[model samples]
Target chain A: MNSSSYYRNNIAAVYIDANALQLEPVQRAISKLTHVRPQTVTSVAEIPAAQRNLRTLYVTSFRGAALSACPGTRVHRCCNYHTVDLYAGCPLGCSYCIMQSYLERSAVTVYADPSPAITAIRAQALAAPEVPLRVGSGETGDSLLLDPLFEITRRYISELADLPNVHFEAKTKTDFVDHLLDLEPKGNAVIGFSVNARQFAVEEGASATLAQRLDAARRAARGGYRVAFHFDPMFRSGSSDGSPAAAAYRDVARRIAAAVDAGRIAWISLGTLRYTPALKAQIKRPYIHDEFVGCADGKFRYIQRERVALYRSVVAALQQYLCPQPPIYLCMESDTVWQRVFGWLPQQINELEALFAGAPLRGESV
Target chain B: MQMERVATLVQRVGPLDIFDQTRLPPDQLIRQGLTAVLALAPLHDSAAGATDAAEAQLLWGGPIVRRAAEIGVGELPARRLGPLGHRDALMLALRMEARAGGYSWSEREAIHRYAGEHRVALDTELSQLVTAAQTFAESMERYLALAPIWRRAVEAGAVDVRTAELCGALPPAVLDTVSGAGRRLSFSNRRLVLTWLSELCGRDGLHEPAAVELAQNVMQSADPLDALRRLRYPRLSAMEDRFAALQRRLTQGTPLELKAPPEFEGAGYEVQLTLRSRDDLARAIEALQRMQEESDELFELL
Candidate 1:
């Protein structure tokens, strides 16, 4: 187990589907660490309603599409990345987390067995021998929070190490990559960290400090793995560009540039803080009070002009500080925003730079 | 199966002494004479096995009983249900109150308060008796928590349950400003107004009455919704205003139509020229040439 991994301490109970008990990976992983003994059930659905919350960890076999395409918002440019669903819910209670409105009443379910997901991802990578099939496991949950116990990333990193076109990235806000350091021939596996300015970083409940995450990123980079940074849901620091918050964002950019070699970066994504209609009612954070307006899409974002300005400032700092420019893309942004930031809309997926390019381009056009 | 009738005996009670308007109102006595009101006077089972001369609770037709008292009727016709226990009395009171059918906002507030105080279940035991969805304890608390203006607006059919729930989410200090702004707009506008104002109050950390003066001052605008929106989305609204000014300057009195993306949220800006003749086409070309000069400023809005 990784020294920094805060496993089962937060987990009050462990539940496994009765059928999933037959999987060797589930049985072995359970025997390896978990002090909270597993209780067998007919299914994860059998977990009592009262205990079905973030505190409980339900281990079960993922019965649905383990790997699928990112369902990018309509009218926004999608990164065309795919996600694996080995984990169903997140326990990190970031106030702005979208899952709060959806998974508030459910357990943090971990799909224990990785063979099925590994087989599925390998098939996709083999099927498209040329396309860079970027797949990550943090779409619905933090990638490394409880992963040290289950060693889910090790299975993917080891099995998919030979697939040059398959970039298997494990995205996390935690500083728990110590256990992953021993793996050999790590292939094109990348460890992505979600970074924020100092003030906002504190608000990401239970997430590592910015420095801690950067240190972890440096560690992963040193271990023959590329690293990516996501400056996502960037909270507006000030009305004016010179405000303390805005200044902190640039300093954050400077720090990232200093922390690792520019060549090790896979990609960096920027997104302004936005919310669904449901979050507005339940969220009580101080930053949510900023000036926002409903976009053409149903989500509310910081007014359009403000978002463009923030993106320009952050991208400028990242471009200048890093010796070699990394592929920085705006996540789920309108084409107008893309035009404003990069001066051109990426009509082809390859235009996103090395992060997305080299995928076998079939007759299909993105 | 035949049902057994509930037995009640007719009794004459002192008119002004029956003061429980816990159920029906006193308006029933206006044009109609007193059709006996149901009264409850708990009889002590140990000694005083008879009804006391003290005021009895009017479980039904309180309006008739009170109106009879107002008309100088010395005595009122009433029906007495036998001895009632403490729990049975609470159940009967809440049940009869719900039986009044369509309740006003205050009436729902009142019943819910009584039901909550006595641990009486309104949703389950009285589900059939409840005509309004707002009668449930959880839903009633939402409406009851609203500011008086919003509650009145809700009562007058101006605000909706969802909008009221939105207002309920605001800090207690900001609800006044948000709901006050919402009160003036049309139904849909009321929703937008309240939603924006609440968000503004939350995002800016404007908690105290003094801090929320911008919203309060905006109330004096000729159009409250427009003013509140301008305050809520200062940057977007300012950019929109600036773009309009720029468009006017560039068009220079030509029928040249230029538009930025909706909410300035998209990447494309559009230019249109409605032409009817060759001279119109010439003028349109002239305007297009003019628009080309400041395309940077215009496209910046998009």
Candidate 2:
């Protein structure tokens, strides 16, 4: 690991709101990182607003309901998943982040209180014992980015330890897993990584390289944890018969196959770059080179034909690498694209949920 | 100080001997003394009279004092009145006294005309004052001329306080050029565009040091408003540019109108070819064939 490549490299300062000042995990996280003394602020409003380039860290209490349905719009096919917002922003400033426009606050604010969320997850699991519940912590932030500092995932794992029907996933782009290896492994827990083409991974300023992430996956698998990968926001760059995008996906799959057994993999998800209309103005000019056409769903996406082609190529590559192909799904896509790429669409949301529930390591209860 | 000398000259030319005699009441005597002084002073050159009273006083006093000194009055002080402050106060007092005794606007005009006929050499201060006032008046005229459009826009809700403030900061000449284009945008959108551009120019409510430098660059541009729009709505402008490029490429040989998805919201594109006759239809078909041959370029629009 590069000494300077920690997930918090871009954070210039860290502030702790008065309500969260006594949280031991937050304090320990601050002490572990080589940042300046955490200044105590009465509220997030007291901290000076940061520029787009400055990563200001805020440890504050989240007052809203901790666990909520994924706020997917009606125009897209949603996985009917729930999200626990452990944090609200990312230190890694990917160019196409919806949070750039969606979030009014520019700082990366970590919610100090997770008890309410854990309780909500427990209640949800107890209420729906007959059905599998998919809950993740990365809807609004990189779940593992601050794991080494706060050990948040450990708390989550402990909370959901006995829930056979509930699975907790923490998606991230970083390879920060030193703190997670020692935790008693639970089949209900998943550590997922957001993977991309090498061009995007380098250009997007992700904290971890592809090799580092694959290594993290291998270590996590060896440590008895189910691992998942997300090929989200895939971009179109080359026009040759075997495009750079196609080759990059094949290479990623090959690396992952070499690192972990196919049976240990939980799931793989593919999503092309799509953004809200408001984000068009917020996206920097250099990152606007991809071919994005406005779709009927009120977001800019690769045209239907292009998206179908890209997914088919990537799915084929994934199949070639693994002996038994892992269950793959599309994220925030329409039924038409799903049908075109996968040859059939799930008749209902639960049917799709069932597919995720049946994945090899994902289905192992207790 | 020059003003005091000019006042002395005015006393010499007047018929009243009140300053020497002083038989009347103190207030009356002071009033008579001022009348004598103002009687000789020209108060109304056409250009000077058009200016505000304060500015007119400065312009008239400079020439009158220089002329009185040049004419060699032995009773005149060795030095001009203490400084600009004392001189200005004394002049203001005399003018007030003259007005109290029924000095009409017509009388002031007559004095101004007389002063113009006996014009003295222009002093440095008086010349600068006149130049500055004239420049200000000219700008005021231009602003007034554009006020109707500004008022209409404000009334129509096309311009908000922030946008108006930004426009106000711009040079009058640039505002005049851009006002036509600005009027074309909807009220809310115009505000949105202007506010966005203002921030890019670093004038986000509080003035930043960099904004002045950026404003200079804006002033030097051939079309400042267009430059501002490009910076403010870059994605929209780029989309328009690409559409135009596509239209030019496809309409090379046919009367076809190509429409991309509204706001590029969808991947599908449409082409409309109008035909008035069989020949026109054939020509349209030929154009479509040509477009099909170079379909890769069309796909780039995605």
Candidate 3:
């Protein structure tokens, strides 16, 4: 770490990779800064074994369960545990990434030093004694993409697996599960993938093919790993005036059931397209755009009436397919959506706990 | 904050139909061609003659004079029909009449329509003014509804304790500001009338000494309206000073205090309660409606 170039801001340390300056445009920006100058350092392998002075940049975030308890839980994804932000930015830039709005620091840089992040995770787990440490590393960044280069996934599995109380969810979109095939699969180590219907997978999401994602999931399941699927950013596509939304939803369900077993699934999360003001602007393209997304009430994603109906249709389809259906939760949705689609409001944490313990829904906490 | 005053004020001024047109007063039906021709032309006798003769008569005599008469209806003979040449004055008088107490139903509808129109200068100050007017109504309503609860606590010989308890029921933003004052008694005594009035109805230019004196007369009370009237003039110089000091200490440069947005408070509260309370869904739903009403009041003000 070059002291002259690197300095700490209030919340985050500013690290300008001098190597990034090799690019002429990037270097020009660095030269424009008055105080700081980039310094060239060795590549990943050449980093010295013992460099005590080098202040490591660690991702410090609340655990999911702890986050769930926070007063502002609805806004935050309190996934019932701490999740790792494996990488900074996603390569697969979907039309509606919430990260675009929330994260001001937009770079595709992975924290090269995983030890500091791992240490932070361990410390967090140690701080909470009785609560099962549920930590994930895919919040700020995609969990996979740089898996082969950084080998962070293998490290996460090997290092965090020993802590029996800790659970790690490796969420990704790319079919990057080869690295995990040989590693001992801990039941706590949940492998997850985000999938939409084929149409969305093809048009909006220009990532791995639907077949490739399904193959990856099946392989993970075969390897005795618990799997989860995120039907996130559920694209609302049809004639502009809203016709045949139910068909689109039915297709989405059929694809999910065909791809993976319901029993092997840990949890399925359904999130409709929600956008913040900034993200909406960032994702707005000049031409070849869907105008419906822009017509929303201030800073809200305006999915059409048919789209909401389609969401309900998709939820219904999933309920019909996934036998002994895995717990379905709507992500970042209003209570109105919950009632209109799910027909019941979400159970409270205690009620959810009771449901978790196989208690009947007593209609008390509707 | 019930916005009862704004509603009352709007009613006194007239109907939504009156404000819908840019022309002030009910009868001054400014010719559409006149407005269009004025936008392009300058002030001159020749330009005035450019309009059709019959249209010119409607513009100058019957409608304009009638409007001038309407505005001068309650004024003394000296100020009556005074400065009829100034359209701005007419607009200001009309605005005052409509928004004196608070937004009337017609004024609410007119303002809403105005906001939707491109002509209205919907800048931040105006936005804040509109928002403050709405929140004032909402906060006062909440305070009034919960008054018995607060009064009970005070009569029990624990004024501070009861105030604290009542404060708990307030939205976080209000509670935070009230708490920072070391005692909400200041809010109850001095700031409440002004702040609440400012929120429910805009300052209404009562900040002017003459205007303040006029309003004091109209309100028929020197005790409460005096403080409320004082807010219109002077423009809260002391509160601004205190706010600056507090900003330096707490927020530094960054905005530490989120303006208690009256719209989302109820939605947020009900959403949380509905999720949390399973058995009393009906009670939660009812509370949600009250919150929605409060939110509706804010929109009405807007």
Candidate achieving the largest DockQ: 1
What TM-score would each prediction reach against the true structure?
Answer: 0.76, 0.56, 0.43
Error of 3 at B172 (Å): 48
Point out where model 3 deviates above 4 Å: A1-39, A42-81, A99-106, A123-133, A163-165, A202-205, A238-246, A285-299, A303-308, A343-345, A348-366, B1-302
Task: Write the residue-wise lDDT of candidate 1 on A157-206 in tens digits.
Answer: 99999999888989998888988998988998989999998877656888
Off by over 4 Å in 2: A1-9, A50-54, A102-105, A238-244, A285-287, A348-366, B1-302
Minimal lDDT window, size 10, model 3 chain B? B33-42
Q: After TM-score superposition, what is the CA distance of residue B150 in candidate 2 from its true location, in Å?
A: 19
What range of 10 consecutive residues in model 3 chain A has the weakest lDDT sum? Answer: A52-61
Could you arrange the candidates by lDDT from highest to lowest?
A: 1, 2, 3
lDDT of 2 at B301: 44
CAPRI-wise, candidate 3 is incorrect
Candidate 2 or 1, higher TM-score: 1
Q: Give the Å error, residue B207, model 2.
A: 31
> Scored by Cα lDDT, where does model 2 land?
0.63
| Candidate 2 C-alpha lDDT tens digits along A55-169 | 6778887678879977765466666578998978876767778887766456777887788899998998899797778899999988988777787788898779788878789
Interface RMSD in Å per candidate, to 1 decimal? 2.4, 7.7, 16.7
